[model samples]
Target: MQSGLTRDRLIAILMLLPSIILVAIFVYGFIAWTGYTSLTDSNALQQLSGLPAQFIGLKNYNDLFTGGLNLRFRIDMVNTVFFTVMFILVCLAVGMGLAILLDQKIKGEAIFRTIFLFPMALSFVVTGVVWKWLFNPTSGFNVLPTILGLPAGQFRWFISEERWWPFAWQDVPLILSILFLGIAIFAALWYWSKRRSQTAALLAALALLLLAWITFGNPRSLSGLNPERPEAHGFNVALIAIVIAAGWQMSGYTMAMYLAGLRGISEELREAARVDGCNELGVYRHVVFPLLAPITLSAMIILGHISLKIFDLVYTMGGGDNLYIDMPGINMFFTTFRSNQFGQGAAIAMLMLIMVAIVIVPYLASQLRSETKL
Candidate 1:
């Protein structure tokens, strides 16, 4: 029986080998290759001549953050933060509002739900293109004012270079310290509740170290990473239009998730809340919202991931030449293709990967810990 079981396991392994090998070669292999490229001083000529790429260590990264030529990248980072915040906030608000309305079982509910969700069927590229024309200052939405006998509005939309909520690069360390310490604390709380003492202890230690560093250590040394030390980073006003388009495209997705979560909730629980003399708002505030926390978290994680790697919409909506509304994606494209700076391009790609990983890995770790019941 032991020999037979061994043979069965061997056969299963053999059967799965091809898929495992493919994923390793295509996915993991490419990531490794990209990392290597980022460390090299590769350029168009070097790549074409089949020359051995010169390893320049972190020079490419240094150039992006301190060499002063890639200020657009710094702006892209600012735009991303503001865009992500507004996009997620708007989508959550609108989605939850819609879900609550549909939960009322109003007339033509199916039709309304379908109408709201129809945008999800379209790609971001499509949404961007449509919104681009709609936001034309002289024609699309601008003409609406004329219909009311007002002069055509002069909002430049994505063409505008205006900014808001400005901050210096010198303040980055403070933000990073707070953000990382918050994550560490959150992880510790979760693992501790699971009774995973070792993991929880490690997380607590990490949190303590971060807190100590922030409270006592010289965090100022880590600041001033931006190349243009005095240049301001801010919420680029041009990104607001992009946020609206993104929110419209994704709000329905969140609405569906919330609707499913709401429906999954037992009506008896809601009735209990009412029986306890809880008003409609109180029922949602105390019972419904708490129960829907997981769904909200899941939606935020997914949406945040998308927002970080946003490329196609911004590319298609504003075209690649709009300097006022440039994003990391567009910057990477121009660097790699137009300027043929493979090293810098790869560095940008790696940074993008890091940003997404930061958002995803924590959530995945927590999910696995819960699943294992440890």
Candidate 2:
């Protein structure tokens, strides 16, 4: 019996070995190769000749953040920050609303769910194309005003270059450090309230380490390593159009998550809340939202990574060359493929990976911890 069990386990391991090997090589191996390339001064000839590129340790990343010729990358970073925040907030709000409405056992519930979820099935490229038409400066919605006997609307959509709350590039490190400090302090307080001193202490330590790194270490040189000028960076109004498009496509996914979370909550718990003198709004505020915290965290992490790595959607909507709303992904593509600046492109890719990992790794660790407890 023991030999039979051992043989079964051995066969299972053998069956999984091919997939593990493939993932290790194609996924992680390529990631390492990209990291190595990013540290080099590779160009088109080297790529074509299959020759190793010269290493220039951190130059590509430094140039991207604080160098003279990389203003576009700075703009992309600022835009990413605002876009990620807005996209996640919008998706959560819209998804929660839709989930709540549908949870009331509305008529044609399945049809409404299918309709809402249909966009998630479509590729972002398709969604972007559709939204681009809808957002065309002089054509789509602009003409609707004229049809309504009003003058044609003059909104520039993605072409608008107007910035809100612009700031000097030099202050980036201080700004980010402050933000990190705020979050860390908040988490420490929350954990302390829960009497989780070890977790709270760990968060405080990590936060301090990050603050030190941003200030003194400056790995990506966020302190303006070699700025041409401390160029103004801020929230681009043009991102509103893209945000709307993205929110439309991705909110359905959040809705599904929220809807599942809502259903998992017992009806009895809600009844108990009512018996305790909680109204509908109070029930949701005090009970439902709190219970859905895990879902919210998961959604934010997932959406945050997606927003950080967004490529096809931005490319399809604004065109990579659109200075007003160019994203890191689009810029990376243009740099690598269009201009054959492989090293710089790889640097952008690595930065993006780092950002996504910052958002995802904590959530993953929490999940693993929960599973171990279970």
Candidate 3:
């Protein structure tokens, strides 16, 4: 019996060896090769004529981040930040709202859930095509007002050059200061609500305030002596149409995740809260929502990564021409395939990988630790 078992295990290992080797070669090997390529000078298509790749460590990265070659990278980075933030937040809000509604045992729950989730069944290309028509400034959904006997709406969707709420990239210090102050205020409120020591809360708030003050005490200090005074382009309102389309497609996935989480929660716990004088809203706010923190984090990470690496939707809907809708993925494609800048494109890919790793690695580590504890 022992000999037979050993032979079976060996056979299993041999059967899996091909898959393991393929994965190592195709996945990890390619990743290593890409990293090496990013550090080389392989830009022009002529360089691909069997010539050896020349080593040029870190130049591509530097050029991408700060070089005066083009504003494409910087602008794409800003647009990516705005798109990811808005996409994740809106998806979470809409998903959670839908999940909560479904959890209440509403009428036609099955039909409603199906309707919400149906969008996820469609491909990104299809979603983009549908939205492209809907956003056509002249002939598509924009003409509905005229059809309804109202004046035609003149809002330009993806082709608009107008921007609002603009602020220079050099003003990041001031932005961070304002954000830190707001966080400090929230931290103080949270501590007070939790009945933590007033002294501790006050000290925390004071420290944050001091940091903010140091960062942005003077506009001149924050802006620096030779800051690049580039034209500010605030959050593109054109992205609103894109966001709505993406959110409509993704919110259903989030809702399904959240709905599963809500269902897994024991009804007894909810009833117990009610028995303890908690209203529906209070129960959700103080108990149910807090309990779904893990689900929320999971959904956020998933949606955030999707938004970061998004290509098809933007490519199909905006055709990568709108500066407001440009992302690293589309930019990398254009740089490498269209413009034949292989090194810079590889660098962009590596940067995007790093960004995704930053968001995902911690959550994965935490999950492993929890599983180990279990």
Give the best candidate by lDDT: 2
Measured over all alpha carbons after superposition, the RMSD of each candidate to the real structure, in angstroms, is 3.5, 3.2, 4.2
- Candidate 3 yields a Cα-based lDDT of 0.85
**lDDT against the true structure, each candidate:** 0.88, 0.90, 0.85
What is the Cα-based lDDT of residue 368 in candidate 2? 95
| Stretch of 10 with least lDDT, candidate 3 | 219-228
How well does candidate 2 score on lDDT at residue 53?
Answer: 87
Residue pairs with backbone overlap in model 2 = none
Per-residue lDDT of candidate 3, residues 103-129 (tens digit) = 989999999999999999999999999
TM-score of each: 0.88, 0.90, 0.86
lDDT by residue (tens digit), candidate 2, 133-177: 989987998789888799999999988988889887877877877
Q: Could you give the candidate ranking by lDDT, starting with the highest?
A: 2, 1, 3
Evaluated against the true structure, the overall lDDT of model 2 is 0.90
Off by over 4 Å in 3: 1-15, 46-50, 173-228
Local error of candidate 1 at 259, Å?
0.1
